[model samples]
Target: MNGGGSCSLGSVLCVITGASRGLGKSLAWELCSRVMPGSTLLLVARTEKALQVLAEELTLKYPGITATWVAADLGTGDGVRRTVQAAHEMNGQDTAQRVIIVNNAGSLGDINKYFVDFTDPQEVDKYFSFNVSSALCLTSSLLKVFQGRPGLQRLVVNVTSLAALQPFKSWTLYCAGKAAREMMFRVLAEEEKDLRVLSYSPGPLDNDMQEEVRTHTKDPDIRQQFLIMKESGKLIDCHVSARKMLDVIQADTYNSGDHVDFYD
Candidate 1:
């Protein structure tokens, strides 16, 4: 284990996407303490207030660490490009040796009720953009940046959900998008043998998403099942999941081309 607080300094840079709340926020905090204590963290989230709060907290708590916030919608081409550029700038335009990319931003939706639900097609588009496209785009851009740095341990961690493993009735679009995102990481892992890419499902969490599920489900029995799971403490918390992800990233035990589930 790396002992020094400045372990993240000198050569490491970690980029965390969707770092406003829940698992993303927890992961950002954990990473700040553990792997990259003094490294530069580029936090990407659409919520400016949340990002600002996190950045300020990290700055005050860890004096040596550098926490920068980019409040941008990462589900668009422009957003992805701007995020990559921001990371490059922070890394001094190709000077950083190790870049840890955490693609943790995602969304869930109910597309079963209406196939053409366009109350916010733009929002839905943003979902796909952040969930799938931005991950790929950012990873591709980083790979380009790390092309010549043979000894660098370039890592990309894709945060997925158990929903990708099983099909749910109302979460059709979410399942499809997550599945696509996982497959994209798998393929990228295969294509880039040197770069470490992991597709990880953090399982069900007691977060807003689950609360939404419990509240919105039309079937009482199904909702009860979820409630039972939650009451039984079977549902994982965002912090626990975030810690597990950090362990996986540090251990480098997962197969680059495989999907690792928290349930397993």
Candidate 2:
């Protein structure tokens, strides 16, 4: 088992997507705090301002570690290419011991509309762009980089939701997107020999996304159910969940083709 603070200087490179806020941000911060001081972290987000702020904060707090912020929309192939370029640039010409890629960026479309009522093709496309295509493209690009590099532990954690297991009625498109992303990682894990790909459902959380679900839900019963879940301590804090994910990455406990659920 890899204990805490196992990495040495400049040995680990972690690329976290959707890192501007919520679980992504929490994960980045946790990693910055726990990992070796001089490790490199590549933060990807759509918001430049947030990413810059986070980069500055990490740099200020942990002066030894290098934090590079890449503002890219991972929903498209071009964005994935840019991310790959940034990762290679960060890695420089030296070979890294470990490359941890966290696919944490996702979107839950307008939850108020039912499957039949939500007929906007654009919205459906957007869902696929952010939730499924982004994860797939990013993983593929990174895996290509990891190939032929021996003695390097590559960890890909696909951040999914419990909805992928238990489908929600109003969130048909969102659930479908998550399910597709999860399956992509699963299949990739089966084919890939070097990298460890894990489809992880981080369970529910007391985060902005949950707040959005609560606010957008028109049904009182649904809202109340979420409220109860939130109040019952079932929802894990973002920081705690992020730390658990980091532990899993460092320990390398998962099989190549594993769907690990935080709740389970």
Weakest 10 consecutive residues of candidate 2 by summed lDDT: 1-10
Q: Which candidate is the best by lDDT?
A: 2
Residue 3 CA error for candidate 2 (Å)?
4.5
For every model shown, what is its TM-score relative to the native structure? 0.86, 0.91
TM-score of 1: 0.86
Instruction: Write down the lDDT that model 1 would get.
Output: 0.76
Which portions of model 1 show Cα errors greater than 4 Å? 1-11, 93-97, 111-127, 146-148, 218-221
Global fold similarity of model 2 (TM-score): 0.91
- What is the alpha-carbon lDDT for the whole of candidate 2? 0.79
Looking at model 1, which ten-residue stretch has the lowest summed lDDT?
1-10
Expressed as tens digits, the lDDT of each residue in 1-264 for candidate 2 is 324463432367889999999999988888877666558889998899999999999999888778998889877777788899998788673445777888998888778877888777998888788788778878778777655476777788889877776778678877888888888888888787777887777778889999987788655777788889887877779887777776666566678757777654
lDDT score, residue 3, model 2? 45
Q: At residue 220, what lDDT does model 1 achieve?
A: 66
Give the candidate number with the greatest TM-score: 2
| Residue pairs of candidate 1 with colliding backbone atoms | 75-130
Local accuracy by lDDT, each model: 0.76, 0.79
